[model samples]
Target: MREIVDFDNLKMYINGEWVTAQSEKTYSVINPSTGKVVANVPNGGRNETKQAIDAADQAFKSWSKLTAVERAKYLMRLYALMHQYKDQLAEIMSLEMGKPFTEAKGEVDFAASYFEWFAEEGRRIYGETIPSNSPNKRLMVIRQPVGVVAAITPWNFPLAMMTRKVGAALAAGCTAIVKPASQSPISAIAFGRLVELAGIPNGVISVITGSSGPISDEIFENPIVKKVTFTGSTEVGKLLVTKSAHQLKKLSLELGGHAPFIVFEDADLEAAATGAIASKYRNTGQTCVCANRIYVHQSVIEEFSEILVKKVKELKVGNSIDPTVQVGPLVNREGLLKVEEQVKDALDKGARILCGGKRVGGELTEGLFYEPTVLGDVTPTMLITYQETFGPVAPIIPFESEEEVIQQANGTEYGLASYFYTQNISRAVRVAEALEFGIMGINDSIPTVAQAPFGGIKESGQGREGGHQGLDDYLEYKFISLGI
Candidate 1:
């Protein structure tokens, strides 16, 4: 008999049972690296989503009643269990999401840290007694769990995004129904399995995956789902907000980004060049905060262009499972075409392609692989400048002054993350503050940790995830007064 992956029988997990959808439709999960059919997830629709919400509602009644210490114990157990399966989860994630094994492992580790952090945070949820103005009157303010939550996570950083929401939900003693992205449902389903093994009661955490339209509508319409946390594109985020507003549902959104990576003349050239590769090309440039636009100071523009373009060419693009591969294919056919359209439009609009601007073919063509492309002489009016190039293509532009670069960088409406490279502390601090992004990094390209909140500004997003900020989304506060 051939061996079968338990999750391959991918189905909805509701009230602790791994079951098929009532709709009986199925969606294929494609391995972006090779464009191979990896697995099939249930085509969950409104009926199945309602089932998940019902499970969560039932779970919340008891879950919310648990004492803080009791809830903390469950999170601690979940954390320890995640550590045990960390490597396995990483491998599954890499296969499903087409991220390199190394990066996928890091994501798994990062996801686990959220569980650990929130597990501790559960014990520290604070309440206060307040002095009342009226005589013999007492006032108290307490933070309570926001009831059943609907947590919808995106494909990128599949595990971490799920953990970011679920961790805070669990920590706050709220039951949740998770809708992991269709492209990467395996990890989320596996997480449900692990939660079961960790001794979590049935219905406390339900995992469901399906088409975006019906499933998402079901979640928003359900009265039992008190809170909804979402991570994805800005357009979708707005639609969700509109739907949730009807019932006054709680929301937390971490949406799209067109992050700017600024390279000043005072920056250490070598470090900036090195960091550019990691910032722009890691995971083949699918990151929400990956340096979409690189603004280089004119003084070092030529030198930076030469070094950066050379490094971009040297990166190996292939299967994510291969340890040698530094870049992988775009996530799907839609993603590949989207990036290709942007690249072609930019090229047609007088942008000079300095290196690699075409798609891979022959044996490589079987996959969604595109070369790491670099463009120069790009004007701000071009589509590539205004829209997000979430693929491996990056456009480099030169600026003459700090004020001009900052103005250009902040020109875009999206403001999730930005990067600066300068050795001078005063200039770095000044530039970092001036950039109109929620998150800024100086001399670094690494994404923020669990201790720091992550989100965007303006069109980028509203609300936050990770750190104590994540806990903020899962709670609601009320004040009460007593007179004797």
Candidate 2:
């Protein structure tokens, strides 16, 4: 079969030019499906990160000066280019991140939607004119770009995460320096190429791939960076908060989530089952918002478990290159090990495995593939109950009352996303309001969209990523009072 992407030509994008690391060093990006090298990306460090930051800083002077409508045109062109090369971008994401090609294609469209949404949203950035308290006085509030922004993205959904941040930043007239996760930098590099083709000015956007520590260090220390947006683990998010404290930089963190999927007896069993499968196993459950704990009404636990297991069993697991495959390998061995450890802990704590419980063997043994798992008799004490199991394992816990389940769901420190299925409109409203999570789905499995606000409360991090609120973090609101 012909290769979809030219892996050899990939390089770091800085100042509108493709370049290699100053150290002449590179790192191999491994394909999780086969444990083989996919491509060697530039191993940038502090020096390259600084260069990218400087470029963005310089670009900000012009980029931020442009009218919001003028910036929207560049984003519109890039959005068109993304659709034009969607197949190649999807292929690269699948090879590097080990997500199914179909899903990757969906992600490409999803990523591009941000550019499309923000392109129009930018034009509507409106300032307020407040009534003056005294005669001959005028009061007004206007929003302006926050200047150079540093976006640190994650491996899972690499393209979508970067676009969610960069799109809003650029739309708000901020230049961005992105440090994509080393494991999946190719997608960002490819997007940078599209940015150049869109006729965006030099230094408006830069994609640097390399060591996370040094890159992040440079971002935190640089005074040129006025805002920092990140999507990753809670531990890393906390560290960024600490680092940014010294400089008081604007920050938007979309951190770890331990979402709860509650299934009430009143819910449609078939619909609940399908939603559970989609929520718990999408991207092999590596997503930050993937349902971690499932709380089923005790009366319907058995029926729900059977239906969920049947649907999970129907999912085909294989290499991402396979068009028919629904489930793909974990991003790396560490992710696989965490899944194994969580399963073992649940089993040891007396949870029963209904369908899948162990790693897949045979031809798939070389890859980081785990069977889509379902565990019954799960309790709060079990490791899988509270921890964010970043894998395709569904642990079912039974609850007797709405009050009891609500308490259990809100027990975790992370409150990023939650879902509950109910036929009763009153119960849906009650549960939705009670859930402490930032984002909630009353009956829907996939609730995220380019037009909605996406973020979390509590330890799941702060600030919004989508909607008009998405542009808020990238902008600074100024109030002017003048006496005539």
Candidate 3:
């Protein structure tokens, strides 16, 4: 066994074992930056998924019985190891997921923080005694882990999202089987190496990569998996919802998001533009929290757009491994195609391409890289504004009144995040309160933190993923009564 992970050939982790699929099935992990094969991974189908699920189930009996303090030690160890290999982990993510090297490194740090945060949180999982209504009666409520968890994370932010679910679930004394997105499964496998180094028990953590259909079926049907945590598209989340209903599994779905970035007339133009750029282009705008719609007041739209386009033009798009590059390729060909379609639709609906609307060419021709695009003359009917663009394209729409902007922002069914910049304290407070979203950024660009509650509302998905509330979804409460 090589101590250094080899993405050229990868294996699924099951019951503390790194092995290939029993059926010898495999899928190639492509480097989105090069359109080249990075590695071939086990296409762990139903049989493989079942093996991981069973391993998790068997481990759960003893793993869940461990004291919360004991479990935290393993998580802390994992966190330390994650930090030690942070650079290597970031490189793998950059290659596999098409994130800029700098952003990839940042994601590794974010991932480590989740484990470190949860390590401390594990010991704090407390219960309380209830006030009995009747004399000579005692009542208490206790929290317990919700058994085995199947955490399905997306290609975007693969490492951080997986850790977000696993850290909290494991901290709650629950075992987990991670099914990472096929496009970026190596990051998940690399994390499994850290879990192994942590000296955690066998079967306590598992990773599987394969087609979603067969793999998802086994995970949902497995009676041993009591809870499921998923972060992906809302449509897929809905499918999981229907599938998990047969077993009534505990579900935490952090699904789709169409975040709105609103800049008021009175906002500091520099800060407003900077916030727009950071919020809109991080992860090349694939993040669920990425600003999808840029709503600037009619009074300041021109100035804001000018500043934003200047910054956007300065962004260097290239291979993700280039440290100086600020923008990278989309995750895969489909992502590129989606962005293409959205831009075309917007153009057909009369939206103007202010700076970028086409793909970049040169030595970087092999990758799925799209230029950082800014669209003006964006209308309410344009497809780019209505749908989750999930690209570096920012559509700057104009609004007149605070009430009008709020209505436009809340019009989308997806409400994962909303951002507004205003110097007027009253306007900021009013707009933040009125916007329907799980996360709000009032003048701040990147608002996500390990200590803050992270998630969305309505079709954007359910359940929180961080802060003190992160562990709640992975746990269940039991009430006890005694008559003395």
The TM-scores, one per candidate, come to: 0.96, 0.98, 0.98
Question: Given candidate 1, what's the lDDT at residue 308?
Answer: 91
| Candidate 3 error regions (>4 Å) | 1-3
For 187-291, candidate 3 gives per-residue lDDT tens digits of 889888888888899999999988998989988888888999999999999999999899999898998999889998899999989888888899899998999
- Which pairs of residues clash in candidate 2, taking residues 3 or more apart in a chain or in different chains? none
- Please provide, for model 1 over 146-202, each residue's C-alpha lDDT reduced to its tens digit, 9 standing for 90 to 100: 899988998888888998889889989899989999889988888888878878888
Candidate 1 Cα misplacement greater than 4 A, ranges? 1-8
Which lDDT values do the candidates have, in the order given?
0.86, 0.92, 0.90
RMSD list, candidates in order:
1.9, 1.4, 1.3
Is candidate 1 or 2 superior in lDDT?
2
Best by lDDT: 2
Query: Model 2: per-residue lDDT, tens digit, 251-304?
Result: 999999999999999999899889989999999999999899999999999999
Model 1: residue 174 alpha-carbon error in angstroms = 0.6
Clashes of each: 0, 0, 0
